[model samples]
Target: MSDGWEDSADAWVASQGEEGDFGRRWVMDAPMLERVRRRPYVRALDVGCGEGRFCRMLAGEGIAAVGIDPTVALIDHARRLDPGGDYRVEAAEAIGFDGGAFDLVISYLSLIDIPDVATAIREMTRVLAPGGTLLIANLAGYNSAADAHGLGWVTLADGRRVHAMDDYLEERTAWIEWRGIRIRNWHRPLGAYMTPLLEQGLTLTHFAEPPAHGGDPARQALYNRAPWFLLMEWQKPRAGSSSGPTGRA
Candidate 1:
């Protein structure tokens, strides 16, 4: 069977438009761009770059970016949208690039779609140059865990909305459908993401749970009840005697 993204590529692209969906536009992009702007990276790779939106944003910031996705249709749409941009049909678990090829690598809301998170993380790290940065934006573990199990918030007698979570420690795949798009996302605990990076010797440098933007007061308050997205930055250590496989980490 085809990955659901291939079937939903056009709709997905249409939904993202020039900026991105709401969570990306309001919650994620600004902080991500800010982090990237602080450094002077010449080359960047966007893993699972749906429709190349983030790649285009990177180009706008004067960084040369190459976007890769497993879905052929999404890549075609991305290429069509940016004619001159570099977009490829590739999977994150097996990135076809030389080691230490990029000064920065970004995985924006794509880790959830990948089945083999550990392998993908390793591949992403392998292509990062010494001291290069790896930035990731993902659904918060609490939100994903609750959603995967069909759990949602409940309004208490005091009018506080509370979300009760269970099965958070388990790792599994769940299907989600929105606006004629259907896709599967993997749900894993926070440690499932952090442990592998630490094991691979990448150092976590920064983390954030940026508040929701652009929504009304009530909607914004609803989103602010819990973080919808989690942003993390990890860096390969500078070249030295203690550096690991990809020169740094």
Candidate 2:
């Protein structure tokens, strides 16, 4: 059980050529950059950073950023792409860094790939400096739940398209295959993602379910009916504070 990513690393990197996949280009990257640019941070870490794209983006913005991933091939590719970047072979469950080392930590679409979600979340929180932020972009619970059971949108007799969802409460691993790539992704309920941060005393600062990209109308229409991704911003409380306010977008 190698998570199926070691073999797919080349295809994955190629699929995200130059910019990124469609979702990353239209939905994830811009919003993520906007959020990170709004504040100043000395150091940033990208946990489970596939190919180190986001880390490179941060470095281009003058932020000292490092990327870590468990997959050797992907880490090697990242290092080759940005020779000066600090990319390491590390796992999300036990990041090799001191506590309070990073003012910003990002897990962009990596949580789904991590099997030990709780431990990974705790480790991410541990490395974050007090008052720091943790930004995560992941497959939404709805999409995961639906895909787990092999359910997708189906047309009704009355010309309505609806997606059927099932087993959302069950936490398990599911296989996804597409265009010469295969990977195992964990499907956990929404609470499975939020509760760990809450338990660690992190505050939910922002949440977004952005609409699909504009250029492809048909694809946009399908996504408008059901969001494919979820973005969340959680912040560690400042010294002497128990919690912070939550924001939604």
Candidate 3:
């Protein structure tokens, strides 16, 4: 795969210091991890695995996981930081895996970055085992970076800062460069994200809008300013498919 974004992603993730910090706190909660643990999936895929934080988390629990990202540096960092799990440099729209290859496929906050998100979702469904589960949690809905003034920057070619927020009009690609690294972060309404799943025959099993970490006043203010998080569980509908636990919103 031709990856032009590798080095910047590495530097950006490395800049984050640890596997559990940075902006991921909103998505990687204890309750969410527990939900993943109790699921029936044995084989899994983490799309846009970034530094492979969650992949390593899943591996630590003994579930076999393959983390895929088009950015080579991110994959390399994931390998170096989390040695036990598998990591690959591959595009979300073109994951080089066989059909029905995974019992679960997860895309954390990474979904909105891919330009052809619908195609990626379909590919995820195509490679998912019958009755497999797809878990997506991220900054979506009325809550998005757009509301956070993220729409103003331009991301450059070295993967830093080149495209502006208004550039998202293309529908297939959208990202901004921070410093010099290109970060594909697109913000869309909740329905825009969930509609594809329903069209692809995936049933919504759970939805959540957990209150932001309540301790920090600044965070609480931002949480109130925007919908900071939304978690949704989707399942490939089939007879006898287990209905998972419903979470609070």
Clashing pairs in 1: none
Q: Report, for every candidate in turn, its global Cα lDDT versus the true structure.
A: 0.88, 0.88, 0.70
Instruction: Give the local distance difference test score of model 3.
Output: 0.70
lDDT by residue (146-241, candidate 3, tens digit) is: 423463334576767322333222333344565556655666656667777777778788887766554467655555554456778888855455
Cα lDDT tens digits for candidate 2, 1-249: 779999999999999987888778877888898889989888999998989898999998889999999999999999999999999999999899999999999999999999899999999999999899999999888988885434467678999878977888999887888767898998899999998888888988999997766647876677778878899999988777666344211
Taking the candidates one at a time, how many backbone clashes does each contain? 0, 0, 17
RMSD of each: 2.4, 3.3, 7.5
What's the ranking of the predictions by TM-score, best on top? Answer: 2, 1, 3
RMSD of 2: 3.3
lDDT of 1 by residue, 68-153 (tens): 99999999998999999999999999999999999999999999999889999999999999899999999988888875433357
Lowest lDDT sum, 10 consecutive residues, model 1, at: 240-249
lDDT of 3 at 236: 81
